[model samples]
Target: MAYVDGFVIPVKVGDRQAFIDHARQMDAIMIEEGALRIVECWADDVPEGKQTDFHRSVDRQEGETVCFSWIEWPDKATRDAAFARMGQNEVMMKTPMPFDGKRMIFGGFEPIVLLEKANG
Candidate 1:
């Protein structure tokens, strides 16, 4: 029963290198803040429907693709405490953000089931 912070954001097209750099910085901050693991992903194969049909999201003047990322914390309390320090985190404050954070969709998820942790 760990805590998970999930997010889906839009990055500038053709800026893969910059995105990776940004993630590297973000990784450190998350780890320092007690994150167990961070998983960042780009929309390799988005399912067809409202997702691919997103209207006026972060971008997609003519319907572009998207990416997602998440961080795993020991528990909800840890996650909450860590996020509370975001305003004062030096790395979080110094790192350059490529996308508009306001436009991103993010939140905490209570996993109904985690298979990886289940198998002994």
Candidate 2:
């Protein structure tokens, strides 16, 4: 089973490239620290909801876009240990985030079900 850390963030439209560059730097650190894989996705068809939605969830502003990302680890223990080691990691501490950290939403999840097709 994999332990996953998920994030939804609000980034300024003008900072898309900056965010990708930043993710590349930070994601490498996570991989070195033990993350099995990481994925960063930009919004394409997110629709506004009458009551609530991804945009509202992160308080996304008029010129911002929502990004969904995740880090996968072999297990919770590995994830926890890796994060612990990254506390005060020099590169992580120095890399600047292109989004508003205050509006980011993140959580750790234990998958309840997963299905995958075998690759040819």
C-alpha TM-score for every candidate:
0.81, 0.96
lDDT of each: 0.76, 0.94
lDDT of each residue in 45-116, candidate 2, tens digit only: 999999999999999999999999999899999999988989869888777789999999999999889889
Q: Which ten residues in a row have the lowest lDDT in candidate 2?
A: 87-96
TM-score, cand. 1 vs. native: 0.81
Q: Please, what's the RMSD in Å of model 1?
A: 2.8
lDDT of 1 at 92: 86
- For model 2, how many clashes? 0
Could you give me the TM-score of model 2 versus the true structure? 0.96
RMSD of each: 2.8, 0.9
User: Cα miss at 76, model 1 (Å)?
Assistant: 0.7
**Pairs in clash, predicted candidate 1:** none
Among all candidates shown, the one with the greatest TM-score: 2
Candidate 1 lDDT over residue span 1-120, tens digit each:
588988778766666677778998888887888999998886777564664543245554333356688998999999899888977887788877876676777889978788764666
